[model samples]
Each structure stands twice: as structure tokens, then as C-alpha cells.
Target: MLRVASVLSFFAGLVAVTIWIATALVEHAVERDASRRSLEWAEFAVWHVPRIDDLAQGLPSDPAELAAFEDLAHFGGVFRFKIFSPDGVLRFVSDDPGSVGSSLGTHNEHAVAVLTSGEAMTFVKDGREKPDRPDLYSETYLPVYDGDRLVAIAETYMDQTTKVAAVRTEYAIVGAALAGMILLALLIPSGSLWVMFRRLRRTNAELEEAQVRAQASDKSKSEFISTVSHELRTPLTSIKGALAMLESGKFAELDGSAKRLLEMALKNAEVLHLLVDDLLDFGKLATGGLEIRPCATDIAGLVQDEVDRIDSYDADRQVECRYTGERGPLFAHADPARIAQVVRNLLSNALKFSPVGGKVFVSVRERCGAIRVEVKDFGCGIPPCDQERIFEKFTQIDSSNTRQHSGAGLGLAISKEIVEAHDGRIGVTSAPGRGSAFYIDLPFCEGAAEAGAVELRNVA
Candidate 1:
């Protein structure tokens, strides 16, 4: 508001200054032309009037001379005319006979200016003080020269009220136009800015509403997952227990195709249980309920344990598993169970993607004051574009319906959540065909640093 007021004030000042200058120039020109015309008339009277030299000798009694003086007084809007001798005596008065033969003072300013400069002099006088006249008058004085000899001075007074009115009217019209243009220049952009401000306010309101709705939808989805996971886990637990009993020969003896069918049922039930657990974990993570219990633990031992477990479980695949890194213990502040889960997930992915007889390598070491673990596999690697989003919930590299892989695709996502809860980071480096290497980095515990047992080593 202050800025707008300042702009208006500046524009008004500019207009006022422009009008003042223009009016001054026009008035000067008008006054100059008036002075020139008045002087011309004075010169004409001096040329045609009979013998002003005789008037200095005495008052003119000739009727023709007196008539000429009267005609000069009334001509061309002239109000009064007077003739002065070189010695400052008023020789003749055209309108006022009473002032004839009066001796003006030697210091009469107008007479002295005309005689010395030989130039016309003009001035204005207000007649408002007189009872009989109420108008402005312009007076001019010029010296009459009879062939390089100063003879007398002629003075004329002319009414100028009409010309003054015309100049004032012209100034008013031009000033109004310039003021209108300045107002228009300021108003147009101010109007556009006001409209844009309103639109921005409306857009901000819509965005706030959309954000509220999105948050509500996300809460509803998390509740639904939590409820469904709890319901499925109860039945899945019973089915898994029954399958375990049958596989253990506690319910019946199984052989041949019957034994194979029992094993398949047990495997599928376990997979279902794992899926239910994944769903529950996802819900807990979304609701900020997933937490880590950190303790000092040997990272190398954890990796070795997960590798041994995977080897025993997937013995039929005949895949090679190797652990090579720091021979000494690498300890970090982390949740042991959660760290184990993360390692297992990485190892499981490596095995799943590897060909039968392909190698899976697990390594653990200290790097940059932190414990680092890497699980690498010689398998079909991930595309560069897909690597970034591979750890998101339910995202699978091979997502086609007929793809040669199976699972709920929540392992990597769950692992990422658990690792982050322990203040660690997990990522993968891969290409189309070379292979994939998944790594975890965790901060070292104070105890591990004090123990002075941590060392950096290269993985074979």
C-alpha cells in the first residue's frame, strides 16, 4: 500500500511539473508577441503623428494634430497614450488633458529605459483597485528616433484579460490529458497483479485440501493391511503346524509321491506364513511402530550364520557359498536380530537369482569407521533404471506373469526398513548381465572402537 501511494504521488508531481513548464513557455511567447505588436503601434504613431517636436515647444492647438493624437489612443485596443520629451517633460496626453505639460522626475524609470536602451519595454498592471475598470492591462514604452536623434518616448497601455483567459484554458486542457495518461499507466498493471494474487490464493487452498485427503487415504490403507495380516496369520500358523507334524511322521507315514506332496504343502505353507509376516511388518513400518533394539554384536559372525543357514536350507540347488573378508571380529552398534534379517534377505535374493551351481559370496569388513557387509551373486543382474526402486514394497525385478521367480517381493523392502531403524544404509550395485552386489553399512559401537579389533580387508 505504501508503494502504491508513493507511485501515485510521483506521477502526480511529474504531471504538475510538465504543465507548469508548458504554461510558462506559452505565457512567455504570448507576452513576447503582445510586446512586439504594442511596440509596432508605438513606432507607427511616431511616424504618422504630426510633429511631436512642435509639442515640446508648446501645446498643439492645430485640430488635425489633436485628431491624430486622439486616433492613436483609440487604435488597436490601446487604452491610453502619452508622449514624453527628451528632458522628461510630458509633452502631450492623448486621453487625459489635465496631465499636459507636467514635468515627470528625471529618474522616471520607464522613460530612462526607453531613451537609453532604444528598445521597447513592457509591464503588467492590475486594474482591480479602480471602481470603473476591473481587468489586467499591459503597458509598453518605446523611444522615437528622428534619424539617429532621440526625439521623444511613446507609452501605450493595452487590455489583456482575453488573451490571459485563452492561455489559462489551453493549460487546463493539456494538463487534464497528461494526468489521465499517467493514471492509466499506473492502473493497468496494478489491476493485473491483483488478479494474479487472487489466483495464487485459490491454488494454495486446493493443494492443502488434496494433502489432507492423501494423508487420510494412507492411514486407511495401513489399518486394512494390519487387520488382514492378523487374520491370515492365525490360520496360516495352524496350517504350518499341521504340515510340520505330518512331515515329522507324527500323524502318518508318507512315501513316494505322497511324501513329495507333503513336502510341497509344507513349503507352500511356510511361504504363506512369510508373506503374512511381511504384510504385518509393512504395516508396522508405515505406522512408525517398527523399532530396533541395538547392542554390540560381531557383524562377521552374523553374516556367517545367515550363510550357513541358507546353505543348509537350499542344499538341493548345489550353489556354492563363500565368506571372505576380515578374519578379525567387526563389531557395530546394531540390533542383532534385525541385522541378521537384513543379511538373510540379501543372501536369499542372491541365491534366488543365481543359476544352479553359481557362486554366492558374503563378506564383512570395517570401512571408514563403520562395519560393511556385502553379498554378491553371479546371476541375472538388475537394470540400471530399476535398481533405485528395487527396495520399495512389493516391487520385483521380473514382474511378468510367466516369470521364473516366486515370492511376495517384500524381502528387500523389509530389510531396508530394519537396517534404517538400526541407523544403517543398504543398497545394491548391478548391471544387465554382469551380476548384483548388495551392501550394508552400520556405524561402529564405542566398545568395538575401544577393543581395537576392527580392521579393513578386501573381499575375494
Candidate 2:
């Protein structure tokens, strides 16, 4: 509705300005024409009157001279006449014999202007001011020059065409012509603009529908992944348990080849299990089904335990893991199991990147009412450009198939989701070839950082 009003206002204002300008032009042209006509009439009067050069200096006393003016006055459309001496004393008034001998005095400015400039002057006035000619009329003062020496000025009133009628006629004709041209000017662009506006609206509507369809497709994809991952997990767990039994219990005496084949199968199965777990977690995060339950969890203990678990799980790895942190329980407001999962992911990443005998360090600290746990490794460092991208889902800095490390690339993204659910922040600081440090900062549980490990145990 507001758009419609704005569009209407714009066009209305355009039309108003155009009419105003057109009327102004018409008025100017009419005034110029009137002045030209008045001057022409004055020149005609001087030429027709007999001996006008001699008689124009004063009122004509000779019978022949008076009769010449009387005959000229009788010519059609003549309203009145005034003959002015060089000093602006009125020598004659054709309409009023009483005004003939008076001085024009202050009103003689128009006469003086004509005398000094040796040019014609003309203007329109109401006729009610004159008794004999009570209608609309114009007055003109044309210079009567006798070969360059000014003789007198011929002041005459002509009442042939009223100014109001000319204005009305001019306005009608000019208004119609200009209105047609302006309408044509407006119609051409308005049609094009209308077409473009409709096309833009159609394009916007199509884009909106495409967006709705895309959202529905993404939701379906997450649901399918969640269902498939859940179904694969149970069987995968069963296979891992059976493989462990076969390798340890009675199949321990198997031949060398069989043992080697069994180890490879077990390793591949574990890898498949980890992939399925990551997929399931990713689906939950995407669907907004992932949640955290907060409590006073010992952040230092959580880091140490996960580090040990990763080292034991990957015994073939030739990397040394070191931990330097608060000796006692350093509590943070977090869910223990979820935070442990985050620690495991960070530790596993650190160990995978560490070269032979290279050390990975884990530390915990409390500062600014928050508990921060950090994992550092002296491995091939991340570039500044890829630091933030590493935390995105399914992303790897070395994405080629021949890259040494392999995973679903959902670990750090999942860790980010989990930490944020507890109102925590995670980030990394590193330089190329200088290794990397990844840290998670979580709010400290109230009074929990100050409480002793013994006190925590008693509370539990």
C-alpha cells in the first residue's frame, strides 16, 4: 500500500511541475507578443496623422492639425490618446479635455523612461479607471523622433483584444499540445519499467520456492543418515567384539599368516566403527538433536584420561604424549562424557600429526572464571588460512586421497557443537611449520575450582 502511494505521489508531482512550467512559458510569450503589437499600433498612429512631426510637440491649435488627429482617433479600436511635451507636461488628452493642461508629475516616470532611453514602453491596465473606455486595454508610449532629435512621445491606448481572452486561448491550445507530448514521454518509459518490475517479481518468487525445496531436501538427507548410522552401529559393535574374542581367547595360537590377516581385519573394522559413530553424531548435530547436560566435571582429569586412552588404542604410533596441568580436580561447568569425547578427538588429532618420537602436550588452566584445556603437538603446522576451515565438517587441510591421515572430518566440528551447547568457546593458534595448539574454554562451575579434590569426592 505504501509503495502504491509513493508511485502515485511521484507521477502527480511530475504532472504538477510540468503544468507550472508550461503555463509560465505561455505567459511570457503572450506578454512579448502584446508589447510588439502595442508598439506597431503606436507607429501606425504617428504615420497616419497629418503633420504629426509638428503637431506632436504640443496640442494642435490649427483647425487642420486638430482635424487630422480627430480623423486618426476615429480609426477603429482607438480608446484614448495623450500627447506629452519633452518636460512631461500633458499637452493633450483625446478623451479628457480637463486633463490636457496638467503636469503628469510623479506618474511621468514612464514618459521620462521613454524620453531618456528613446525607446517604446507598453503595459496593460484595467479600463474601469477611464469613463469613456470602461473595459480591458493596453497603453503604449512610443518615441516620436524627428530625425534623431526627440520631438515628443505618442501615448496611446488600444482596446481591440483583451489580455484575458488571449491568455485563455493560448492556454487551451498550448496546454493540449504540451500535455500530449508529456504524456507520450511518460508512457514510453512507464511501459518498459512496468514490464521489468513484473519480471523481477516473478524471478524473486521462483527463487523463494527453490529455497523452500532445498531446505526440505536437506532435512530428508539428515534423517536418512541418522537412520542408517544407527542401524550400522549395532552390527559393527558385534563384529568388533567377536574379532577381539577370536584374536585373544582361543585363536591366539593361530599361524603367522592367519594372525596377520586377523590384525588387519580388526584394524579395518575399528576404522569402520569410528566412521559410523562420526556420521551418527553429525546427523544429530545437523538436526539440532545434540544436547549437553552441565555439571562440575574435573577438566584436568578428563584431559589426562583421554590422552592415555588414545595412546593405548594406537600403540603402533611412535609419538610421545605428555601432560602438564593442575595436579588436582579443576572443575568446569560441563557434561563429563561429552567433554571426554572432545578431549579424545583433540588428543587423537594431535597424535596422528606428530612425527616419530615427537611430543604432544596437554595442559589445563583456570583463568577469568573459565577453565581452558589445551592440546599442543610438534607436528606439521596448519597455515593461517586453513586454521578456521579445519573446524568445519568433512574438511581436511590435506584433502588428497594419498594424504597419510584419514577420517570422516567431523571430529572438530562435533567438538565445536558440543562445547557451544555448554556455552563454551574453542579456537586454535598456530603458524606454518611451528606446530599448532587447539584449546577449549568452558565456564568454571561456581566455587568448584576452589574446592579440593577431597571435597568434591565427599560431595559426590
For each candidate, the alpha-carbon lDDT, in order, equals 0.79, 0.78
Point out where model 2 deviates above 4 Å. 37-67, 70-199, 241-270, 294-301, 324-336, 364-373, 382-388, 398-401, 419-434, 441-460
State the weakest 10-residue window (summed lDDT) of model 1: 451-460
Residue-level lDDT tens digits of model 1 in 330-416 = 778888888887887788788888989899998998889788899999899999999979999889878899999788788899999
What's the distance in Å from true for residue 385, model 1? 1.2
Clashing residue pairs found in predicted model 2: none
Query: Which 10 consecutive positions of candidate 2 have the poorest summed lDDT?
Result: 97-106
- Candidate 1 residue pairs in backbone clash: none
Model 1 has a clash total of 0
